[model samples]
Target: MKTQNQFQLFKERRFLPYFFVQFFGALNDNIFKNALLTLIAFGAFNQETRELLTNLGALLFILPFFLFSALAGQLADKYKKAHIIRYIKFVEILIMGCATIAFWHHQLALLFVILFFMGSHSAFFAPVKYSILPQYLERDELVGGNGLVEMGTFVAILLGTILGILLIRIHTSTLFISIAIMLTAVLGFMTSLWIPNQKTISNPDLKINWEPFSQTWYVLKRAASQRTIFLTILGISWFWFFGSVIITQLYNYNQDILHGNEAVMILMISILSIGIGLGSLSCEKLSRHKVEIGLVPFGSIGLTLITIDLSFAHGLYPEQVINVSTFLSHWEGWHILIDLFFFGIFGGLYSVPLYVLLQSRTEEKERSQMIAANSVLNALFMVVASLFSIALLTLGLSIPQLFLVIGFCNLAVTMYLYKLLPEFLMRFIAWLLINCIYRVKITGIENIPEEGPAIITCNHVSLVDPIVVMASCHRPIRFVMDHQIFKIPLLKFVFQTAGCIPVASEKENPEIKERAFALVKEALDRGELIGLFPEGSLTSNGNIQQFRKGLERILNNNPVPVVPMAVQGLWGSFFSRRYGKAMLHWPRQFLFSKIGLQITKPIPPEEFNLEELKNITQNLRGDWE
Candidate 1:
């Protein structure tokens, strides 16, 4: 459960074999892909031929996801995922063997056929690769597991791409590359043999639908069953769109604009890969081993900023840098390298959380189907990116302009996503507050049940009490709070996204108070966690306020269990009322100041009372204040 170093998963039979299977598969695909692309773009100068080969190659590889993913999802769900993976790897070996023959015979058309089949091989493997993790890994391990997988994926990509570029330029290079891919495929199949098979079938009684179009629609609809899941899917597809655009254009961006050769392109890509590896590794630590979607916006902002900088960073080195050393000799080259590096870093940050969220939220029986839908969407978006890139370039837009345009488009997309579901923004804020401003020690977090309706009673000590409590729980809580809290500029956005119920004193606004209770009832009926400060308001002084009787009102209607919580060590801080007013007086509590959230086991309705709840809160706070 520690999962501090994702590399430890390599020792796990559940994870290690599958890791290699995916790694080798990715490596094999990229090596062949980059080699063919290098041959098409750089091996010849035929304009029409280059355009045709490049477009055809991209289309051929991505088309399978559109056509066969539904079938892949069905097979993965209906049978043993491990068996499907093994069979896919076996197919990969055959595909790579054919690749070798085509390379040997200089059969261009045959190579494309092999590429399509390779795509088919991956299309089948992807659903099983993703969906099996939840079965193999614990909830806490999901983020780290995904981090390792993503890191391995990009690392494989880095090695494959660099190898593809270097090997193709050598004497009898295709011979070497062809042999390498075939051997990789064999290694993939062999490692996949060791992946432990699960006895449980996700859907044994389900019937397979061979129809691609309608089944594709069925899977997509299923994946989008929840609003958050669908939006996450959209966010994921957008990432693919961004990635494909950058990769598809990197060759042209290097040549036409930077006047660089293959070495420069390889160097740029390598930095990006390294950045992604580091970023992916950091997710577990930054998110504290949780599926923190907060990192999504952070990653998106970094991505947009880095890309926009890339547009301006270029044109510094007008002349060609013959080699990597020469490219590094100029600061301008370093700028481009840095831009691409952060691109990878933010990309990893953006994507890892979404995968974790998607996997963790989905139902077991339909997990593979959901992932298949995500894959379909990703493929569609990537195909659109390919076409969009071509159209823009053909329209005489410089690569720099293209980057600028994409960056802005990303900004727009994120804004829309955040608006659609404010949780993304709220989580980002809570994550920042917990990780950056306070060193929080969360105890009794498990007391908050993972499911069912519950009322959380806490002794509020500061304006950020809800935030501290919110950050501690695995599930989202709809906190009942003073409506005036929304009047605060910064806290307003956070509270709004968190779906905090804004209540008022009955004398001040009776209708608002009525509506607040109505919303609370609705949320509890939906099996959500509702957090409210039993003291009714933040302590005007440093002492805990008297518990009001409103707690009984909530319990009367709901009869749900109560989770007693306490927030401590926040008095006199900026958000606490100890310093005259919250946020008005910024006195004390430097970065990472000690803060603690303590929760008691859920008190059943039979045993719950105001006196006992307050006593539990006091004990949890434990003389801290």
Candidate 2:
């Protein structure tokens, strides 16, 4: 039986310890960094030195990624990750000690050094943090796991940033702040102790390469070989770029443009953070905990459109520059806030799947290296975004204009990527159609094998039948379809990319029929679920046709369990026979159609009598005839 409860995911020891460790790590990092930034802005450095110090601080933080990430990736692959994390936390304590001295002496140089050390700690920790996810999770749990991690990280950042600023303003002793950081590090270290020893998957006998840049590049190239993984990495990097640009610009927008106080800054960040948290949680609900990455493009489109809306809402230099409170008092501010929230929501939708894809698809031995490569990409993109922001400001563009540019750029990048990989766009279209237009309720999904090969037998009722099943199935499926349908102008690209098998009737094209069966057999042999409509063709009438014999041949040869399934409530729709001449029909309601899927228990080959299975499927289908 499958469960959807969030707490149920933590019952396994493999995830909980790591979860706490990561959560606290994020919390502490944000707390200290925000505190340091506040000190610099307020009094730690004079205005003349503040800009240089702040930029240097940013450089020092990202520098470790460029300098130590390859070595970090190597270490994560060389030893047990639990031990490494423990040692890293201990180093964090020592770094905090340095922070205490810096605060006491009011030494800017010492503070910068501590910040660099903190970044170095994060650099070393990055590879292990992400790479260990796959080892602890089942493939099905990957999405949920990644969602939780993302949610936790963002929540921690939000809270820590808020508290860090708030706490420093209380006029508390500097020693107290130092103590808080130390205790947080200790707690994180203790949590690390609870993580079970995960052995190194890659025991590279070769000595570590010290040339970090070249070594990191080589690792990235290796990760780029897998098409899906490579695309996912790009997707993740794009997310960081998008997010960093928005959050960084938001500070200036709030302070200078909106004339808002620190409270307003907190509010904007809080809304974005909460939206991401909700969106991350929504992935489990929307996908039913399966890693359905097709949602990525949908998220990207939403994000881009909302950002543009936000830009327009601000308008090009309004006559009155409203303060934060006054802006909120007006309808326009509320509109912008709503837009920002949804932006975060869609942002959440975009990121969760990429994390799952990386975790589930990468080779275990090099998982850490791959994650390090991902971190490197994230750092690189962030740097580029920073540079872009600086350049845009230098070009005399206002903050709002920069926002507009980034948002439009987001649309361009997403479109180009989707054009290159039509599967993403197709899946997005299918997923949106199913979720928004049809209320897809499913039963007996468990009958579909959790792992390994199985044959899915269904009634073919429409041209889009395969897509309906694809959208609902928990796992990926290769569908056998009519060759002519596969050749439809724009759709041929999608069908081919999805690797759907195209077949002609034996009487029509014997060679195509033979090739189709061969592909089906090969897919099943590789433990992939293959879907075939036993009717051999869509019914011209709104009823299930007589069962075909191909399903029998498949089961006899492979001897795997057979899952019988059906789709109800689609017959009267435009895609069905009820529409005039089928393919000529247009979409019925823009956003309200009824659809349902039901599955019967898997019948072993020995128990699979074709007539019996057909009758059982008919009964389960409940008179779709």
Candidate 3:
């Protein structure tokens, strides 16, 4: 089946209703929270008490996720997600009713209680909302669906914050805020009703853990059982920590560093939010509709570099309040904005993939539990970040230095993760090379086995052929490469990390050829897939070269199902020798070129032959250039 862009999912019944449900939920959340902040800031409380109350307000809202997420996760896994969502919305309406009453009477006590309940409501809803995506959308649509959800959420935050500010400044401020919160809750409930039912994936008889501390520990243990899941959760939490520190300091950054007022702060926020939205939406296209973890590292690099630059850029602006118009008129302001924009871009790139990875990898029964664990850890990380920032600032570190330290810390963390998980970096290089030069469309990817050993045989089209094929494959591939080309400078590192087996013509290097064959045999024996370019080298012309006999030798030893794959639209590219010596020619016509990889049904071991594989690959790659 052909893959569809993420936006197309919106037209389907499965995604649209849920999108609105989430959108409205986030809108109501930010509306109430921001409104509370405004009131506490401007209300009769003294300045010292106001700071305490505002911090308390933030804590109350986040505390529920810490206290109740374990229970929420259990309910989400044990019952229909749609049902849980509807019931949660019903609870939200009640919470908003309390909020309305508190606002009407201007009772600080009841308002704090309402805030705590709102936080609780969000905590319960968290696992259900995230875990429900994998249930409703196809695997290919995960990134896109997540992108839209994130974008919608941020947009809601932006709009809701603005609305709350406007409401509190009005003549009948209390009345307007009360009515807005209630009406939004009702609308959210209405949308939740339209969300399609998603049946529970966990056991109905599973015991519900009511003890938050022990249950939370149990939940975390379950997540840790899956190493990648646990690491990614940590990764996600780290992003939150990094982001919270940055955002919290932005208020100070606006006043002390940028020498700007609230208007300049808004400008910074707008640029960052817009950048994230764009970055998130672009993931589907950048990843070619797959959950490419490579983007995670790619994003981390951007995050580090841009953050470092931001530290330098902030120093260029003088410490005096600059109007928004004047801030834009200066190059220093533009530099700061650029840094913030790319920071959001990399942040989006960092987050979207990991979230999709969690959804795609977690067992359906434990998915909600896993998400709840993530929520709890994320909250913990943010809280820790606040304390860390305060300590750093107290130690005489300027805001810019704090950013610099975070950036340096980010580099250290990412490098450690990459060393632990080389797959991340390998995939990053593959994704980077492919996306930087070519737009690839892959079809029949499902024809490859989801698990277990299989042989993938494709026609060689360019020096970068293996990288392209690697990027397209969902599972890691052990490619067999010519020893000479395998030793090429920078490409050697990527090839070595990817586990490419180096071979030479038996006449020239008999021992190396034997070792290559032996390695392929062992990989297949271990239930791992090996990708081979049957034509054995880059195509000198724009046509498929004849297959070599290496496949026959490998299959003779270990008979395995062989998938015939093909690459088209790369013959004349700079990497291919179609124009002249590959890599020597400047990329005049190859920049931003589109390419395609097509896979046909697997040929049984009993039916496979060298000549037959060649014909099949050629036909699959038909008539491109």
C-alpha root-mean-square deviation, candidate 3: 3.7
The parts of candidate 1 lying over 4 Å away from their true place are 1-5, 46-52, 316-321, 486-489, 505-514
lDDT tens digits, residues 234-293, model 3? 889889888877865665567566777556766787788788888899999888778899
Model 3 poorest 10 in a row by lDDT: 46-55
RMSD of each: 2.1, 3.2, 3.7
In model 2, state the lDDT of residue 436: 83
Greater lDDT among 1 and 3 belongs to 1
In candidate 2, what are the lDDT values of residues 502-539, reduced to their tens digit? 99988999999999989999998999999888887777
Worst 10 residues of 1 by lDDT: 43-52
Per-residue lDDT of candidate 1, residues 1-625 (tens digit): 5444677888899899989999999999899988888887676556545655676788789989888999999999999999998889888888888888888887888989988998988899889989999999888788889999999999999999988887877779878988889889899999989999897999987799998999999998887778888999899999999878877778766766776778887888889999998899899888877788989999999999998998898756646436767777878889989888899999999999999999988888888999999999998998898788778877878888999899999999889988998898888888888988998988877788868999988887788888877876668999999888866787888887788999988899999989988999999999999988888788887777689887898889999999888888998889888878788896788998988888778999988889878888888888897
Two-way TM-score contest, 1 vs 2, winner: 1
Q: Against the true structure, what is each candidate's TM-score?
A: 0.95, 0.90, 0.87
Candidate 3: where are CA atoms >4 Å away? Answer: 1-3, 40-59, 105-113, 255-265, 312-335, 439-453, 482-489, 502-528, 535-560, 568-598, 621-625
Ranking according to lDDT, highest score first: 1, 3, 2
Number of the top candidate by lDDT?
Answer: 1
Instruction: Give model 3's TM-score versus the native structure.
Output: 0.87
Candidate lDDT scores, in order, read: 0.86, 0.79, 0.84
Model 3, residue 41: displacement in angstroms? 5.3
